[model samples]
Target chain A: MENVVELTNVTKTFKDFSIKNMDLQVKQGFVTGFIGANGAGKSTTIKMIMNLLRPDAGEVKLFGLDYKTHEKAMKERIGFVYDGNVFFDGLNLKDIKRIVAPAYKQWDDTLFYRYVEQFELPLTKAMKTFSKGMQMKASLAIALSHHAELIIMDEPTAGLDPIFRRELLDLLQELMMDGDRTIFFSTHITTDLDRIADYIAFIQSGELVFNQSIHEVAENYALVKGGLELLDRDTEKAFIHIHRAPTGFEALADNMKAVKSIFGDTVVIERASLEDIMYYMKGGVPHV
Target chain B: MKIIISNSSKEPIYEQITSQIKSAILAGELQEGTAIPSMRKLAKDLKISVITTKRAYEELEKAGFIYSIVGKGSFIAEQNLEVIKEKKLKVIEEQLGAVVTNSREIGLSLNELQQLLKIIYEGEG
Candidate 1:
């Protein structure tokens, strides 16, 4: 498969948190969602990929070439939308576009205005006065206006209401229709990923947990539940993480087949969601 | 053909799509050679993940229920009696397997389970 973003053994460190040797690949023609709890290295990793923060070691590549070699051209191919505005708060949509659009090689004014109309953004209002949802929409308008091959967004829908969130997800789906644009969607909202993500890469406490296709994640893991009697040490060992209650015990097993073989149909096995897997893998609740 | 997806339901979204399409084919609601929406189009309409729809289309193609032409949309495949029969049997086996599990969990014997199924089937008729 063609990869649009590749990070090989990338490492970044801060005073209190650090990303260990992390290897990531965002393939072409898909939406790859990066998710983690707050304070995880998601932002650090994204910054490294964008060259906003240089990695302490290893390389970051875009379009299969080192990001630094042809930074100007490579930057042109990527459209970015991050939390808060990347523009001056005093600038209206039109003024902001005038400043930002000149940098992209294929920026189209007609397309930009079209998105402005579609998103119902106020063309003359200062960005700072816009609602959070409108600001995000305005940012997305900018991102989608240019003919970008890859669009990277960091929590684009994090604080928006459900209506706008759905609209944003719908837009992302429409964008994928072209079949050539690759999207890097980073968010803490795992539920949003359930509907649109092709591949999901998760980070926890600066550690890479898993990066796999949605099908693999959903199919390969299962929620195993049965009477509390089944909570013997050996059975617990078979689970990725286990939760117990007085009436029953439940566990998330990474290897569904292994769990089935161990417990058989005596215990109920349920399809696990992305959120369920994430929470359980993080050693989620085990309340009794 | 109609496909209903529920976030709260236990069935995976992709499986719901495939099963619905498969049933449509078996019931002849979708005639052979009928063109179907592209995977992206279906996903957009369903407001679901593109990958989920893609997986559904892939499984349908793999099962010989649909075929795609380059650049053109996928269409329902010509029915092969043997293939359709085999596929339907597999669906039945899956349903029966679930029945077995439920019955066993409830401590119902095989004979009792069969009797209950007969009563339900006859009552429906």
Candidate 2:
């Protein structure tokens, strides 16, 4: 299978938190959601993929084209939407489009007009006068109108109402129906990914925790609930993360058969959700 | 679906899903060709794990209550009406037995328990 985006042993560091030894791939024609907690380095990894930040080690490739070797050509075909406003506040919707459209070789004015009308964005209003949701819609309209084959969205739906959130997801779904376009969606909202993402890649503190098909991720891990005795130091060590409750406890284990064997009758293994997996990866911390 | 499950009920989550789905099929609430929620969606709705929902689905398939066509999805299995009726009655009786056992522990006569059940069923409890 062709990979639209590939990261091998990618690493990035900050003064407080650093993501190390990471690797991931976003396959062609699929929506691969990059999931993580607030400080799990999701944005950091996305930056590396977009080549905004140089990785301390490893390489990122787009359509088998190396980022360093084909930076200009690669970027033209890629639409990047940062988590916040990347356009100037003083720039009106039309002004922003005017500036961005000329940068892409395949920019389509008809497509741009279609998106603007569909999103119901105010073309004459400055970006600062638009609501956050409207600004995001404008950003997306600009991104999608360029005929870009690959789109990298960073928390594009973070502050949108549920209605608009669904709208954006629907747009992406429509885009991917072509079977040639790919979307790299980075968000803390797992529920957004739950609907349309074909694959999910989880990043943690800069490290690539796991990357796999959504079906595989949903099927592999289970929540084992039992008495505290089930989490004997040795057995607890066998699981990824453990959460203690007053009556009993819950833990995520990849190998259910092994966990069952170790704590037969004492532990009941239930299925784990992607949200649960995210929570577990965050050291059982509650989702804020 | 003619199904019963309780978060506080002693029955497991998988049993709740399977038994309800089975009852729905047998009671004609869910038709033979009716599509069921995928394991993942069911889990999300119930806020449980996919594993538990999958187990319920697997058990349903094992009991010949449903079958899944890969990539196409899962549906209720077609069965003879008589066989479906029998399975439904058997499960109903099993539940009635458990209710009777608990009713007896409360020092209620069969007549009184039946009255109480009537009230409960009528939403007068």
Candidate 3:
């Protein structure tokens, strides 16, 4: 399968932090999730892909074309939605429709109108008057209507209600049904990823931790909950991150099969969520 | 098709999907040779990760509750009546064991637990 987005040893440096020596790919026709906590370099990698932030080294390719040499062609097939509103406040929905949508060759007014109706945005209302959710919906509407082959969204569901989030996800799912389009969903919200993401890429302090299929992660990583005494077991100590808790310790293991075999029936082998793996990988304090 | 899922259940999403579909087949809710939704369509309808749904379908195929013929979608596998009966009994034993363990943990006597289980089962019937 072709990768919709590809990065090879990509590196970007800043005064404070940098995305270092990263390589990743977003498979075609799959909803690839980019997950990380704050300052985990998720945004940085996205910006580099968009060419909004120049990478100090390495290459980015979209549609199997060089990102630098074919920047215009690459961007034409791409639609981006950043974390916050990225539209002119003075522009009304009609203005966006009349002016912005014309920038793409595949722009379809019919599709735009469908999204407008589905998202419940008023064509006459200025964007400033719209709620954050409405603003996001508008952006998404434009992104979808443009008929972009690859859509990259950054934290698009950060503050939306559950209903809109579902709506947006459903729309994305629908778009990929034809098996020609792809979506790169960047968010810290693991729950949403749990529902829609096919592949997941985890970033930690500007480095890649894991980039694999969601099924692989869910099936392999397990949240092993046990008492403090269980920590003494050599097998349990080999977990990715071992958190000492008030009552007991919770650890995440990539080799869940091995852990279960070693511990037998004593250790509780509970299914781990995407958040659980990310949390433990970051050395988080156990909340429960 | 009847589908079972728990949003906040401790079980992994895929396993829940796999087991529920298996039970539905065993209960005759999903009949043998009935065409099931493709993994993509099922994921879209359930609003779940596609890979997760695919895994569920894969496991179901492995366990013989369903089988997929390439190019065509998945279908419930026809099983011998004896095998179905055994599978249903195993499911019941697992549920009953969970209830009995919980009852003991909460200090309920065996008789009381039996009465509670009977009441719940009767209500379901």
Candidate 4:
């Protein structure tokens, strides 16, 4: 498996916040979901990948090529969608295409028109007049028209309704049939990832926490519930975070095997969803 | 071939897929050398991530229930039916032995156990 996007020890600093020593890899030919809370440096990391913001320290490469020498070549193969509309507000879809289409050598007018018809987007209406979902569809139509091998999206599902969100996931799955395309999208909506994401890259407060396959996550992390009597200095080592209630105690365990061995059948271990992992992680990563 | 997935089931999606396909092979529904849908195609049709279908197919291959070529898709593997049947029968015998011990401990007669087994077998059909 090749890595389409790679960041090695990347450091970017701002006046108020900084992403420190972040090492991330987006594997080729799969959907890798970028997940974190708002203001968790997801957008900052994406900007670095897009070469809009340069990392202060480390290397950022796309398709094994550095942006310094291959900016034009790399961006040509990468399609991007930002959280907010990056298009001109006054321009209609046709005018937007006219300005954007000339930049890509592989842009296909027929494919663009086909996506326009399939999405039922109004080509004549101003982009500002279109609804949120329509704007997303318009952006997607353009991103997909150029035969891009890598698609990087930041919060692509932020303000859409549930029905359209599902439709968007289905469309992404359809695009993945090609077997050459790679999708890396950041979203707070974990349900969307559950449906289609192969790998999950979870960031926390400007730090890269873990990048693992969804199956690896399922096998490792779990929510364990048991009596408070199970909590001791020795036994508490199994949990990343513990929440106690009058009835019982619920804790997030990073190692399911260790939890099972330490507690045996005394505790009930359940699969932890992505949201649950994120929520429990707010308590802070445990010291090794 | 049709595959029905239950999201609410405790079993993981890939295990569900592997077990269903395994049963299909054992029941002779999918014959030897029958071409199966590609993992990506199956993933798209089932509305699941491609990795899940890939894992299921990999498991099937590991268990000798299927095989795949580099460019070609997966196919049902040549099965040694006698060996598989014997393996399954051995498992059944072990389960039945446990059931007999439990029934005897509860003072149930062999005739009562036979009648119960007949009822369950017919009802399942």
Candidate 5:
């Protein structure tokens, strides 16, 4: 499959945070999730991909073409929605489409109108007047109407109700039915990725930690819960991070199968959601 | 078509999918040669990732319960009566294997283990 987004040895720096030697790939026909906490360079990396922020070094390629050389053509096929509105604030939905949608060759007015009806967004209301969910829906309508092959979103679900969040996921699922489109969904909400992310890219303190398929993530890691008494010097050393309270001890194991063979039924081996895995891995308590 | 998922369960999502589909086939809910939903369709319906659903389908195919044709879709593979019976027996064999290990650890003989198995098998009301 063709890669929709490829960043090899990409480096970026702010005064405080920087992405260092990051390598990430988003393949066609899959939703690749970019997960990290606030200020963890999720947005920064996304900006680099969008060319909003220039990388200090290395390459940023979209659809097998370098962004620097093919910015306009790449932007035409790509759709984006950020945490906040990137469109003009004073313009209404219809006005914004009149100006922005014309930038793409594949812009379909009928599709845009269809989405407006489905989203129940008023055509005349200024963009700034819409609620958070409405703003996201409007942005999505614009994005989808262009017949985009690659959809890049950063925290599009933030500040939305759970029902709306699920609805948005359903929309993304529907979009990928053709088996050709790809989505890069960057968010702090790992549970959302647990549902629809084919690949998970995790970063902490601006450094890429692990980037792998969700299948491998599920297969490789397990949440092991057991009593504190079970922890000997050898067993304690097995976890990536182990947390102990007065009552019991729980930890994240890098190899579920190995941990299962070692601990067997003595410890509770549970399926760790992306949330649990990210929490323990990025939570950063003093480790064994 | 009927699947109940518990997010809190220790079982992985793909395992839950495969086991549920397997049980349904064994119980005759999904008949032989019946067409199942495509991986992408099933993933969308279940509100899960394509990777996870694909994994489940792969597991089912591995177990000889289903088959997929490229560009077509998956269908439940027909199982002979003997094959089904053998599968049941294999399940029992595993349970008995565990029983033997536990009984041996407690120093029980074969006769005592048989008595325990018989009593437990017949004692269910």
Candidate 6:
């Protein structure tokens, strides 16, 4: 698979925080979910991808083209939705369309209207009057109308209701039928990724922890529960982090196979959900 | 073909898909050369990531349960039903051999074992 977006050895610095040596790739024709806790630099990485913030060091490439030379060509193929409404609050949907539609050469009015009707977005209503879900739908309708090859969304589902979130996922699934469109979206809502994301790019404190397929994530990470006797220094090497209670100890193991081999039947190993991984990883990955 | 996915299942979604499709093929519900839904379409219908369905199809192809033509989608493979059935029967026989050994170790007679098997098999129905 071709990488639609690539960042190699990227470094971005802020006064309080900095993203160091981040390497990430968004594969074409698949949904890549970008996940991190608040202030985890997900938005900063996304900004670099969108060319909103240039990385202080390293290369950022889209469709194998560098932003330095191919900025226009690259942006032409991408439809983006930011976490907050980028549209004018006073402007109505029709007016917003008029402003945004001209930016894309391939913008199709028919397709745009089709999405408008499908999403039931009111064209005459002011952006501020629309609910959060409606605003997301409006944004999505615009993002999808331009026949973009890559769709980038930053926290598109952040404030959306469950029903609308599911609708958005279904819509994305339908769009993926084209077999060429790539989607990279950042979200703290891990449940949304379970249905649509093929790859998960997890970031922590501005560092890329892992970019792995959903299957790889499932196979590699697990939650293990066992008696405190299993917590000796030698045996503890199998776990990424361990939580100890009087009754037992629960731990997150990055290597499921190692955990299984080490503890055998003495411990119970269960599948770790994305949320579990994120929660445990917040303690920070120990350099074992 | 209808496939039901249980999010809570210990079995992975791809395994569920493969097992269901395999059963359909073995049960003759899916005939040889019958075209199956494309992986993308299946993923859409199942409300799952395309990678999951892709993995399922790849496993199906590898197991000789199906074959894919470039751009033409996948079709049920030509099945040797007799051979498949014979192979399965051999597995059952091996398992039954173990059961017999365990039963004898427990001082269970052949007649008692036959009665137990009959009851268990009929109970499933």
What DockQ would candidate 4 receive versus the native complex? 0.81
Classify candidate 2 by CAPRI docking class.
incorrect
Model 6 chain A, poorest ten-residue lDDT window?
A: A279-288
Model 5 clash pairs are: none
Model 6 chain A TM-score equals 0.98
Interface Cα RMSD, each model: 1.1, 8.7, 1.3, 0.5, 0.7, 0.5
Provide per-model DockQ scores.
0.59, 0.06, 0.52, 0.81, 0.69, 0.85
Q: Write the per-residue lDDT of candidate 2 for residues A119-139, one digit (tens) a residue.
A: 888888889988889988888
Candidate 6 vs. truth: CA RMSD?
Answer: 1.5
Where does model 2 exceed 4 Å of error? A284-288, B1-125
Comparing candidate 3 with candidate 5, which one achieves the higher DockQ? 5
lDDT of 4 by residue, A1-288 (tens): 499999999999999999999999999889999999999999999999999999999999999999989999999999899999999989999999999999999999999999999999999999999999999999999999999999999999999999999999999999999898999999999999988999999999899889999999999999999999989999998889999998999999889999999999999999999999999998566668
TM-score of 4: 0.96
TM for every model, in the order presented, reads 0.88, 0.69, 0.81, 0.96, 0.87, 0.97
Which residue pairs overlap in candidate 1's backbone?
none
Q: Write the per-residue lDDT of candidate 1 for residues A85-161, one digit (tens) a residue.
A: 88899999999999998888899999999899999999999999999999999999999888899999988988999
Clashes of each: 0, 3, 2, 0, 0, 0
TM-score of structure candidate 5: 0.87
Q: Which ten-residue region of model 4 chain A has the weakest summed lDDT?
A: A279-288
True lDDT of residue A22, candidate 6 = 91
Candidate 3 vs candidate 6: which has greater lDDT? 6
Best-performing candidate as measured by lDDT: 4
| Tens-place lDDT digits, model 2, residues B1-125 | 33344756557667888877866776678888888876655654554444456678999999898999986779988868796678778999999999999988988799998888888989953
Which candidate wins on TM-score? 6
Please give the distance, in angstroms, between residue B7's alpha carbon in candidate 2 and its true position after superposition. 18
lDDT values, one for every candidate: 0.87, 0.79, 0.84, 0.95, 0.88, 0.94
* Docking quality class, candidate 1: medium
Question: In candidate 5, which residue ranges exceed 4 Å CA deviation?
Answer: A225-236, A244-248, A258-268, A283-288, B90-125
